[model samples]
Target: MRDAEISSWRQWVTGLMVAGLVIGTAGGPLVGQETDDAEEGPQQVIIERTPVQLRDPKTYSVSLSLEPIREIDLVAVADGVTGAVQVQLGGAASRQAEAVRLDSAERQLELERAKALFRVAQAEQRATSGGDANAVEAAEGRLEAARAELRLAEHRLDATVVRFPFDGKVMGVHVVPGQFVRAGQPLVTLADTSKMRVAIPVDRTAVNEGDTVDIKIETDTVQAKVETIVPLKAEFEPLRELFVSVATAVLVLENGDGKLKAGQTVFADMIPRQPVMEVPTSTLANMEEGGRKVQVIRDGFVRDIPVKLLGQVGEEHVFVSGRFSAADELVLSSSEVLLDGARAVPAGAEIPTEEDEGAGPAGRRRGSRF
Candidate 1:
C-alpha cells in the first residue's frame, strides 16, 4: 500500500509541471502583442506648410515730406537796379536795369579797336626808341582807359537784364519791375521741383543707393530712383529720439516729372525683385549660436534648415531664403514635438495657394501693415 501511494504522488507532480508549461506558452503571444503595440508609438500628424516663393517685393508704407532738389535765393547783384519786373518766369518778379550810357556791343567793338591801335603804337615805339617815346606812351595810356570804360559798360548792360538761373517755379517775388533796388536786395525765391527728394527713413540693410522706389503724391504715382542715402548725423539725434520708431536713413529719390512738390506729403514704397521663400514667423526656432532656423518636413522626416532672415512681410509671415525648393514641404503646425529623424504622416491640411493670396503672376503682393 505504501509503494502505490508514493507512485501516485510522483504522477500528480508531473501533471502540475505539464500544466505550468502550457500556461506559460499561451501567455507568451499576449505579452508579445502588447510589446509590439508599445513599439508602434503614439499617433502623429504633420501638416503641409504653404511654401511661398518670396519672389515678391517687400513693401513698406511710410509718410514722407517732399523737398526740392535745390532752393535758390535770387538777389540783386548790382546797385541802381530797377525793380520793374521785366521777364517774369514762374511768377517771379524781375526788371531790366536802368538804361546804360553805351551799348555793350558797341563797347566791345571800341575796345577791340583800341587794343589794335595800342599794339601798333607799342610796335612803333619799340622800332624807334627816340621817336617821341613820351607821346606814344601817352596814346597807349589813353587807349587803356578806353578799354577799361568798355568793360564797365559791358558789365552795366549785363546788370540790366536779370536772367533766371534754373528751370523752376518761383515761390516768392520780393521786388517789382521799375523800382530802384540796391545791391544785395532779395529778388525772388526759386525752387527746382523738376526733381524732388524725400527724407524717407529706411532699414539700412534692406535698401541700397541705386534701388528704385515708387513715390505717390496726391493722386499721382511716379517711379523714382534712389539718388543717395544720407547718414544719420548727431545733430538729428534729438529728432531721432522724438521719432523712436523711425530709422535714421534719409532717402533722396529722383522725381524728374515734377509731379512731386516741395513740402508736399508723399508715400514712398520700395519693392524688392529678388526671389525668396516665405514662411510663417511661428515656425522659426532660435539657434544656440545665433540667428534663426526652421524645421522642414521632407520625406516623412524633419530637417532643421538654416534660413536667412529677410525681414518681415505680412502680419504673421516673414521672408526667408536658403536650401529650400518651391516643392519642399514645410511643417506648418505639428501635433508631435518636431525632432530630427522623427517619423511623421501628413495630416492633409490645406495649404494656401498663390491665387488665394492674390499673388500676381510674379508673386507680387502687399507688404506689412506698418
Candidate 2:
C-alpha cells in the first residue's frame, strides 16, 4: 500500500515537473522543442537569488579567558599571637599589629628612660653649652633618641590590632583568634574578580601582532583587542624558528553584568582574514541525485541550486557556491516533498506587513540524505 502511494506521488511530481518547464519557457524563447528531453531537467527545489555579500561574515578565535589576572597574596609581616582584628567598623589595625602588641610592654619602659634623658640635656646652661658644644650635641642626640623610642612604643602597642588595607571581603582566614603565627606566614589569598582576562593560545601562522579577536562565553559575547602576543617556545614543542606557533594573548573581558566567571570554559569567536559563512547544517540540502542543493525561492518559483559541500562546520555542512547571496531568499522545502523547479507560492505575500523579508534574509534548508 505504501509503495502504491509512493508511485502515485511520483506521477503527480512528473506532471508538475513538465508544467514547470512550460512555465519557465513562457517569457524566454522556447528551446525545449529542439533540445533532447532525455537530459534531466534542473531538479526543482526552489529558485533563489544568491546574495551579493560585500564583506562575508567570518568567525575565528583564540582562548577566551582562562584565569583572573588580578590576584593577590596576603602574608603576616611579624610573628605574634593573634589579637584584636579591627573588630570595629572604622579604622582597622595593621597586619603586623599582633607582633607590635607582644613587644609593647617593654617599649613603655624604654620610652620613659628616653624622656628623662631628654629633660637632662635641655637643662644645660647657655654658657656651658657654648663653651662645651658637646653638651648641645648630647642634648639634641638624646632628645631625638627619646622621641624615636616613644614612637616605637606606640607602634608596638598598635601592633596588637589588625586593620583592613582596603575595602574587600576576607578571602581566607589562615590563623584564628588566639592562634600563634610566625612572621612572613601566609594569612589569606585575595583575588580581584572585578574584571577577568582570557589567555588565548594564538597561532603565529594565523595571528599577527595587534589583531583583534572576539570571545563568546556562553550567551555573552565580548571583544578583545590585541594587547601583546607573547612569543614563547616550550621544551616539549620547540620552536622551529625564532617565533614558533602558539602565542599567548591577554584578552580583556567585559564583565557584562558579571555574567562571566574566572576559569569558566568558553569558546572564542576568532575572526580570520578570510571571510566565512555561518549557516545551520539543516540549511545544507542534497537533491534526489544531483549532489547537494539548497532551495532558493524567487519570483514565486522554488529552484534547486547546486552547492559544493565544504566539510563540516560545527555539525553543519558549509557550502561554497556562487548562487548563495547574503540577502537571497531561502525556501524551506514544502512539507519536505518539494521537487526541483517546483512551483511554490510565498506565504503571506500580499499581506502588506510592516516588515518584509522579500527575496533575502530567509534562512536555508538542509537537504535530507537520500
Whose TM-score is greatest here? 2
Give the TM-score of each candidate.
0.42, 0.44
**Model 2 regions lying over 4 Å from their true place:** 1-66, 85-131, 155-169, 205-211, 233-244, 267-370
* Per-residue lDDT of candidate 2, residues 1-370 (tens digit): 1459647754754554444322122222122232445343322222222332323422222233445546555555567666434332212234332211232345456667666765664564433566667877776676677667667756655544444444333445555556677877765545455566765555557666667777666666666666677754242132122123455666666454655566677663232223333334565676666676666554444456666543243443343443544454554223344444433443323321113443342222212111
RMSD of each: 22.4, 15.5
Q: 1-370, model 1: which lDDT tens digit per residue?
A: 1459647744754453333210001112211224455443233332434343434222222345777778877667666535345434455332332212112354456556666766666665565555687866776676566667656655655655556666667776677645566667766677777677666555566667788766666677766666666665443333232122334444465666555567887653321223356667888888777877777644433566777665565566666656665555665555445554343332333323346646553223211110
Tell me the lDDT of model 2 at 78: 64
Superposition-based RMSD of candidate 1 using all C-alpha atoms, in angstroms: 22.4
Question: Candidate 1, TM-score vs. the true structure?
Answer: 0.42
lDDT of each: 0.53, 0.47
Question: What TM-score would you give candidate 2 relative to the actual structure?
Answer: 0.44
The backbone clash count of each candidate, in order, is: 12, 33
